[model samples]
Target: MIKVLGDSHDKEMYDLLVEVTDLRKFVEEELHVLWKDVDEVRVECQSRHASNGNASISTSYIVVGTHGIKVPKPNMYNNTRNATMVENFLFGLEQYYEALGIVDDGAKIANASNFLHESTQLW
Candidate 1:
């Protein structure tokens, strides 16, 4: 499920936080990203309006496995493109890992460091 909380007065751009209880299901259905052993996914997006009326947005995605946290690069921009960017980023991530021959192993992937190192090259 997706949960959102923010100040009622700030409608221009409020924080959008989405949490998927069953990440595997969500990934397969919504993202179409194949993964067999992910347990949870949390996405947090925040937008702030500066005094000059300019807005800045940032998004972070956290994938939780039984063993550790998988951190993806945070996206930052000055426009309104949270949802699309997040989806695209995740899709790319899935593809990256797949290309590296890394599949979800119920958090049993012992060489997670290798995967993490390779992911950094994507940036």
Candidate 2:
């Protein structure tokens, strides 16, 4: 990975890829998770690159085309950084994940970071 993606943001993906000793186990246990996780990371980077900092949409709801179906966006978590709030956030986040058809733990974990505020990111 270093040779291929040298001096780039490839550390996490490289680590996951390099630790796979068994091909069959990799396919069964790691392949899909890795792909989804990497894809999530790439999508995040691409969005940041495209936006160049101002990434939040102006509106909290998205309107689908002609039908005018409006769906509320998922809530950003960690306003107060309390345990109860975190639990509520997780519950709401899991529901959001379900609505988006995101079932894998890797993708869920990846998505969680995007919703966390700076105050709770380190915590």
Candidate 3:
């Protein structure tokens, strides 16, 4: 884990990334309880070089209240700071949850188990 300092917007961005991680962890745990059928629900944060090799999306989660970006392929010689990467990453994550129809309200938590079951269904 890398440590960031300073109170600039960059720091704010880093904070946002931390928040994203927390949210992912929370959701993953909820999934565990909500969907008892499966014991393992892996929420991965992947960061790799892009085909073209520009900047990479190192962050994979963020707060739903703000812009949530997802993971992007890493770029070579990209000057993007970690904080900026994290903020954009949150935006991506938000998009992912929206696509998955994941509601922030606690109402859906109970149905998480069913959600998982349906997600893996071949039919």
Q: Which tens-of-lDDT digit does each residue in 15-116 have in candidate 2?
A: 667676456676877778988999999898678546654324221222223343343556787578589987888888877766665554555675577888
Q: What TM-score, over all chains together, does every model reach?
A: 0.23, 0.39, 0.25
lDDT for 119 in candidate 2 is 78
**Ranking of all candidate structures by their lDDT, best first:** 2, 3, 1
lDDT of 1 by residue, 35-120 (tens): 32232231112222123232212122223333443545323222334798657655665554454444444222332233333345
lDDT (C-alpha, whole model) for all candidates: 0.39, 0.65, 0.46
- Local distance difference test, candidate 2: 0.65
- On the 0 to 100 scale, the lDDT of residue 97 in model 2 is 63
Clashes of each: 0, 0, 17
How well does candidate 1 score on lDDT at residue 38? 36
* Candidate 3 clash figure, as a count: 17
Better of 1 and 2 by lDDT: 2
